[model samples]
Target chain A: MHNFEFVKPGTVADAVAALKGDEAQALGGGQTLLPTMKQRLAAPETLVALSGVDEMKGICKDDEGRLCIGGGTTHAAVAADGSYPALSAMASHIGDPAVRNRGTIGGSLANNDPAACYPSAVLASGATVTTNTREIAADDYFQGMFSTALEEGEIITEVKFPIPEKANYQKFVQPASRFALVGVFVAKFADGVRVAITGASEEGVFRWTEAEEALSANFSPAALDSLSVSGEGMISDLHGTGAYRAHLIKVMTGRAVSAAA
Target chain B: MELSDSRTIDAPREMVWQALLDKDVLKNAVPGCQEMSGSPEEGFEAVVVQKVGPVKATFKGAVTLEDMNEPESLTISGSGKGGAAGFAKGGAKVRLEDDNGQTVLHYDVEAKVGGKLAQLGSRIIDGFAKKMADQFFTNFQEALEGPAEQEPDAEVADGAETGEKKKGWFRRMVSS
Candidate 1:
């Protein structure tokens, strides 16, 4: 990687200010960005490190009773945090030990990798992505693969997940990367149910609305008996075919709902 | 990895063909294309910077148009080297079909990557490749379709958002 300036700000304002330059990029855990920089695929003139910001690194419940996780909180921390057991369990399985210790929920969410785990939980939980500038609903935050509603220079500050009645995340991990080949998250809310699938769609994480509807009426694995995931927009790669992923989506969703129940 | 996609552009087949052959159009449409030179007949040399997951590299390569049937179908094959990141070589068969006044552009691309990139995993590379193909077609369609009807400033905004997709798979092939 070419030489670049590094700045670690103690506050969000300072961090945001440091990223004002056109060539500046935010650094999060370096799990993804560092390797990218090492390969010289990304050559930012300035590296604004967000790790040093204290306000962006913890977990708690806000006025709305939603679990709010600071953007800088590492996956390891989330994995250990007892506030949300299912989310913590999901975080524990992200990547491996080193990755979990270094990678942050914000980074994973920001990168929006199709195979990433946090997106499924965030979407299923009906979370809110709070940025330095504004708040965005989870539904509107993720645009597509590696895409989000974040505007230029905006920094994600925290994610607020509404407590679900019952929730579970089941990931069919790709052996090599530990990233999901097809992961499913099912959350049963008082009003309805939400099922989100990751590592399957060409367009990235998406809701299994049909499954959601099925489970809303009858919250059980048997409720998903007649439902089928279409392979129309599923991703196909060396790991699995679109059809296989579609099939796994059904299997995983059933397992997740069963586990949650 | 192999990628195949088709897009329907709201333009004539001849116009689509001309746009495909135009260097400026290709340069603009290709994600991370820093420079492109030469012609369709002589083959074009290009420099592109691409990123996938965490790896990024600059690739210098050449592309030659083969099996040309003019305004109908043609094959484009090219290879590039990216020092330590790895290298990639591939070709795509592009076919243009006219449906009334519109043109349907179809492409079948087969590409291979070797080196650190290949070591990273096939799933990431495949995802990146598919995204690049999709972006290329989206850009091509937008170019042919002109600016959006309501957003008069959309064209300028769109141009500034170029290269968001990491491209240069062939370049990420070298040892750094």
Candidate 2:
């Protein structure tokens, strides 16, 4: 790994200013960024650690019942917080105990790995990504696999996830890493249902419209019985086939609905 | 392991086939492809950086056209190495059929990975491979659809979903 400067900022302003260089990247939990850097897949000249920024930590309910989560909150903290069950559940399953203790909400959303659990949760919850510059909807936040709408040096301050009337997440984890091989997060709002999928697609996390349509009608596992996930746009690897993943999507969707119900 | 999948695009077969060759379309569709372009010898070349869990690797590779039936069918083969991360090689056979006015592109792909990636990763290779194929085709479909404002009226299989709900109080949690 290349030698790089590490700066722990006491405020968001300092952190933002510290990210001026082209080779500078914000370090949240260091869950994803550090590993990438160590592997030399990414070699940033500097890492602006956000742990010292007290403003970017914690979770609270907003005036509208939406949960406002500081980007720097750890997975262990989120998982232990009973108020945000969905988000907490996601935090608990990120990688392992050590990873959870160090990973942050902002890091996960910014990195946006296709199989990562946080993306699915955020998308399903219809969250808004609040950055120092602007707020981005979850739909627009994820650009593609391992990509996000975040511009260079732009830091994510917080995320706003609408607490659904009923919601649950179910993932068939890759045993070793505990990453979702095919993870599904389903949430039902007063108006309809939102189904987000990670690990199954090539383009990171995406909404499962067919399952949503079915669940929107009844919000039950049986509602999705007739729906068959499209194998056309999925990942086929040594672990499973495209067709098999499509099958798992349905089975998982059903399980999610059952759990939520 | 061998893995394959495809999608029916809402356009003419000719248009869909042309979109397959378009650099911008491919750049938008291929996962982790930072740069993509057509090479000499009826092939495509790209630079990609892949990150799965704690592993990350960069690859520069080319996809050669093995067989071409124009708007009807084509076969593509390629391979890449990501230094310590690993290496991968694969081929895909694509067939285009006209369903009414729309083009249905059916593809079957077989891929293999070796080195640290194959040895350390779990049984989720199929899942990852399927996702990559889907990204390619979906990007292909979006590109062929152009900047059209209206969503295409098409029939497709069910959509995929991922779930990561809250765990019980006693469950172990991984951060970030």
**Best candidate according to lDDT:** 1
Candidate 2 C-alpha lDDT tens digits along A159-215: 998988888899998665678889999998998999999888877799999889889
| lDDT (Cα atoms) of all candidates against the true structure | 0.82, 0.76
**What lDDT score goes with residue A199 in model 1?**
96
What does candidate 1 score on TM?
Answer: 0.87
List, residue by residue over A17-96, the lDDT tens digit for candidate 1. Answer: 99999778888898988877776667888998999999999999999889999999999999999678889999999888
Which segments of model 1 are wrong by more than 4 Å?
A1-3, A38-41, B147-176
Instruction: Please report how far candidate 2 places residue B166 from its true position, in Å.
Output: 48
For candidate 2, give the DockQ.
0.17
> TM-score, each model?
0.87, 0.70
Q: Go through the candidates in order and give each one's DockQ.
A: 0.28, 0.17
User: Model 2 in CAPRI terms: which quality?
Assistant: incorrect
- The TM-scores that each candidate's chain B achieves against the reference are 0.81, 0.76
Give the range where candidate 2 chain B is weakest over 10 consecutive residues by summed lDDT.
Answer: B161-170
